[model samples]
Target: MKKPIYRTKDEELAQIFSSKVLPRLRRLEFFGIIMAAIVLLVVILGVLALTVFRFKVPDIKLRAVTIDNYSNLSGTLTRFNLTLREEIVLKNQNFGEFKYDKSEAILSYGGKTIGEEEISSGCIELTYTKLVVVLIEPKFEGLGSNQNLGGGTNSGILTFNSYIKLSGKVNLMMISIKKRTREMNCTLKISLVRQAIQDYYCH
Candidate 1:
């Protein structure tokens, strides 16, 4: 009969580890390292893609302005009230459409808010221009009773400023990108007597 081989507990454990458990542990570690490298590469590519396809802010300009009506009495203008109509053009210079949320157009004079109009949510196509019209009713008060109409008293020229605040997200090929805000400030000069816009500038 063949004699049975007797091995120490330490030797058995070391042989088992070398043949079975060690190989499995090395394979698992290698797999983990490969997976981490792949994940890192994916993240780096995503960042690069986002940087290349980033959205740009649109341009806002005051295209035209008109004073519909003006009322004056006693040969000296008091309560200079009129309807101010402004046309704002938004030009999109981006590669994707700009989706904007509800915004406001405010008209102010002498640090006082005189008029406000709501600009509803809308979208501007890529490389397109959108025209938005806003109507403002402003009543000029505290004009001295002796103020002659258009008599070199500032030439009956009133200066007013407008602000447009818009906030929205950008969409790139059905993928939603980051959110941004656009602010437009404009200065306007109007002739109360002629009821016309003299000069306009926006930034």
Candidate 2:
């Protein structure tokens, strides 16, 4: 039989490191580093997308308000009647179209509901503004003792506070995403003699 060859300690150690330990450590380092970089990149992109390219809510405002008709009892002005017309505009400043559901415009006086009108469902194109008109007719039985009436004078001037509420949703690409609502309080001055709105301010 041939003589058996025995390896020295240093040679055995080198062989073990090259064949087993070195390969395992290399594999771990390569995969671990690549995975960490991938995770970091994903997080950065997610944050940028949420903050910089996020969707924005549309702007709604009352463009114009008018009193179409007004009538009251001749001398005492006890019974009050009036028709109000409002023009609302919705401005969409996003990159996608803004679709809204059917909504209502509610009118209130002295914390009491007076009238309500329906706002039709529609969509506003990207970077566009849409106008919606609403008409409300409210009848008052006895305004003679209402403390909320401001300018009750002999010249037939009357003042009151009115509230309007608008509620709807926003849709993107035919998918519902967010809900939107707005409330406006307005002070109105009316002239019973001329059947017109004298002054108004809304907030």
Candidate 3:
């Protein structure tokens, strides 16, 4: 009779694996995966906190404030076709509180106030000029800067000057972490620049 080549229990079995019958994960790989997950979670949370619980200002809000009903304007200009109309857009962009009282807009060219418009908003309009551009072929007695934009250059002479004063209620994050736009009187005086020129040789 042939004896089976069977090993006895006392001889012991090949230790396939230890523990609860499940494949054990390597310590280094497990720790690496855990750390990666933790870092991802932390980054996501940080981004959320900044986006939801702080002062967030928009790029620019072009709200029409002029008496005219138009928002955008475009036209070609010349002697016979020398007329252009435009509506102003005021931009409000800021993280700090707005000082809408001291802000204003003044137009000038060659050291002269050919036209002037005032802006007394209660906040920031840094993205746009307070005095929206007004294009025209004005009757100038001497050869100088008409200092008006939006005329589309019908051939002659033109230049533009502008000053923006942002002042008003500063938008802020409330205690509940909600963004609020509130008006507060502040002083923001943008300087008046008038060193522009335009000479078309319109002999």
Q: Which candidate is the best by lDDT?
A: 1
Residues 1-203 of candidate 2: C-alpha lDDT, one tens digit per residue: 99988999998889878876899988999999999999999999998678534667677777777887666544455456678898888887665677777777766655566677888888888789998888998645334443345456456776656655555555556666666666677777777767787888887
Q: Runs in model 2 with CA error above 4 Å? A: 1-52, 72-76, 142-155
| Candidate 3 error regions (>4 Å) | 1-45, 48-86, 91-99, 123-156, 173-203
Candidate 2: residue 170 Cα off by (Å): 3.5
Clashing pairs in 1: none
Model 2 Cα RMSD, Å? 7.4
Looking at candidate 3, the ten consecutive residues that score lowest on lDDT are: 186-195
The TM-scores, one per candidate, come to 0.66, 0.61, 0.32
Candidate models: Cα lDDT each: 0.78, 0.72, 0.37
Better of 1 and 3 by TM-score: 1
Model 1 has an lDDT value of 0.78
Q: Give the TM-score of candidate 3.
A: 0.32
Model 3 over residues 183-203: C-alpha lDDT tens digits? 211111111121123221110
